[model samples]
Target: METNEDKQAFEPKVVAFLCNWCSYAGADSAGISRLKSPANILPIRVMCSGRVSPEMILRAFRSGADGVMVLGCHIGDCHYIDANHRTVKRVTLLQNLLGYTGINPDRLVLDWVSSSEGPKFAKVTRKFVEKVRELGPMAEEMGKSLPASKINVLVEEVTG
Candidate 1:
């Protein structure tokens, strides 16, 4: 049986995808600078925001992340030259899809952050954490809007 404290102890889980060339470095800088950011974020460093696939984002949510963030180099300043452009397009489409499926699209966020922008990274992460906190547990929506069987069916329909 679950107790009130158990339910109250449910801290939202956040997954952050950070571009290695910028946002990842900025995260390291935040640690070095001892800047205080929310402790809920689980950072995953990727080579570029362009490397993030829709599958990864969906997996994060399916795996119980209350919110997700994708941080990359500023527009026109990607280390791979326009890599963030692909990221922008993909996330936008994903957001729309999430909305269509009755998911709160605000749970996902995309932002530009330079290596020098450690404070900005901290700020963005803090804000994201707060937003997710307000949304409560995403498990509350499972089997209601998006479920494994439903996602598999959607995938099959799209592919086949």
Candidate 2:
């Protein structure tokens, strides 16, 4: 039988948005190179990191992601020419906004990675997974503020 302490070590569900031209390739490279990465992250590829809007991120949270990550080309390496700038700004703001709503800002991470940095991808994902696991589940944290009924209603509004 599993002890309560064992149950307390929750595995978080993470949603990651990766730039198609860079971060996504980096993640693929990590896999091809036989690097170990946490399976908790669910990746969604976009043409550029800038394409990941706050709404999409909020939806991920509303859909029950315990953490979110946005990985893009290193500063100037964006295939779309400086598009990652928007991602940088928006993600920063979203992190603060989520914090204001009682969610820990650390739940969101933004980083840069190149396609050739396979080992770096594995390292980053592992670190992020560990960080989120320590923070525990979003649903439990959210439950302290609002009732489940309210959360379901908000989710419906967002989804619609």
Candidate 3:
């Protein structure tokens, strides 16, 4: 018999890429403030979110992360001044591509958080964790496979 504690103890593994100028600082702020954020997230710091590549995201999924997140500075407020543009476009396209490849796009999330927004960091991480928990494990997704025809079609479309 599984108790409520047992049910609530299911912790999904999350890979988070945070920008050093903002999101990483926000994570530090959350830690400093002792905010209630989920422990599932494993953070990797980058100079900018713009540096998060599609390959990196795919690798996270391939490596068994139940969910992945990229957090960066807000548009126009980026320390690099517009570098976040690539982050936005890339993440959007990647989400769509994930769906096309028969993966749940919700497994990835992108957000903006300034260094001062510790509570927001805590809230967003908590929310993402809950969403992924509901989505279950990456094993469930890995168990399913995309049709070869679908892959071929996508490959042809891209190659053309």
Candidate 4:
């Protein structure tokens, strides 16, 4: 049996996809500025948040990420003009899809952080990590019916 202490000790794995021109720089700035953020976040830099497809987010979950975050420039501040607008739409749709698939939609997060907003980046990451920790592990939510192997098989069937 698991004790409350064991539950409290659970640290979730989080993958954060950050846009290169803004959120990524913000995260880096946070590090350079000595602003503390959660160590559980594995940051992946992309050209733009708009480029983060649903498949990539799903793949992160399939690869054992308990939670995923898509961070980009604030609205109207995107280097790619309105790219983050598309990000908003995609992430919202994906959240609904995740809920339908038995995964907690809260496991995925989408937010904005400009290159100069290092403090915001740190704050957002810390909060997200805490939320995921409270949600426990992804496997717990997925249960046995949707194990990694079964998910892969489903993906293959859909894609092929």
TM-score-based ranking, best first? 4, 2, 3, 1
1-160: candidate 1 lDDT, tens digit per residue: 5567866777889999999999999998888889998999999999999999999999999899999999999998899998799999999999999989788999999999889888999999999998888777888755455447777988899999
Candidate 4 lDDT tens digits, 1-160: 6689988889899999999999999998999999999999999999999999999999999999999999999999999999889999999999999889778999999999999899999999999999999889998777746447777988899999
Once fitted onto the true fold, the runs of candidate 2 whose alpha carbons sit more than 4 angstroms away are: 1-9, 145-160
lDDT of 1 at 75: 97
- The best candidate in terms of TM-score: 4
Off by over 4 Å in 1: 1-8, 143-160
Off by over 4 Å in 3: 1-9, 145-160
lDDT of 2: 0.91
The segments of candidate 4 whose C-alpha lies over 4 angstroms from its true place after superposition are 144-160
Ranking by lDDT: 4, 3, 2, 1
Clashes of 4: 0
Q: Specify the poorest-scoring 10-residue window by lDDT in model 1.
A: 140-149
State every prediction's TM-score relative to the real structure: 0.84, 0.86, 0.85, 0.87
Q: Please write out the lDDT profile of model 3 over residues 84-134, one tens digit for every residue.
A: 999999999999999997889999999999999999999999999999998
Q: How close is candidate 3 to the true structure, as a TM-score?
A: 0.85
Worst 10 residues of 2 by lDDT: 1-10
Q: Candidate 1 vs candidate 2: which has greater TM-score? A: 2
Task: List clashing residue pairs in candidate 4.
Answer: none
Judge candidate 1 against the unseen true structure and give its global Cα lDDT, from 0 to 1. 0.91
The true-versus-predicted C-alpha distance at residue 29 of model 4, in Å, is 1.4
